[model samples]
Target: MALPCAREVFTSIFKTGAVTKKFCGQLKQLGKVCNDAFVKKTLEDPIYKNLSESAIAKKSRKTWNTCASVIDISPSSSA
Candidate 1:
């Protein structure tokens, strides 16, 4: 999981001295960008291709059901 984009952003923040020891507010944008870029890049990776396929297959194999709905007896609901 060597994300170059994320590493670059971190380096920039650290070099600018905008980041502090305790507070990491500078990471807000970096976090968002890294998350978006990582997802995009990970999907494009060859390893993710087969992995995603298998994961999807496993997900599709599972069955899910929603609970039955119950009728409301309140006067507002009746109206």
Candidate 2:
């Protein structure tokens, strides 16, 4: 995924926003390894250092699974 798409996905997971379908497709293309690494890096950010690592990880997994299901259910589309 591109930087913007990664940022968008991070924001969507950490904050209150919906990720665009186009970005979801990009994420699906990138697969879970990239997603896991991205989330792991985010866990190291000082801003989130005070938060529970396990909770953030659990949420990340949930978000990834949700996005995967969404992308699987729909045909790919442009942003």
Best by TM-score: 2
Clashing pairs in 1: none
Each model's lDDT: 0.31, 0.73
Deviation in angstroms for 68 in model 1?
Answer: 33
RMSD, each candidate, Å?
17.1, 6.3
For 39-79, candidate 1 gives per-residue lDDT tens digits of 45655777656545444322212100000011111111110
Residue 43 in model 1: lDDT: 55
TM-score, cand. 2:
0.74
For model 2, how does the per-residue alpha-carbon lDDT over 30-58 read when each residue is reduced to its tens digit? 87777778877887889888877676666
Off by over 4 Å in 2: 73-79
Query: Which portions of model 1 show Cα errors greater than 4 Å?
Result: 1-29, 51-79
**TM-score of every candidate relative to the true structure:** 0.28, 0.74
TM-score of 1: 0.28
Lowest lDDT sum, 10 consecutive residues, model 2, at 70-79
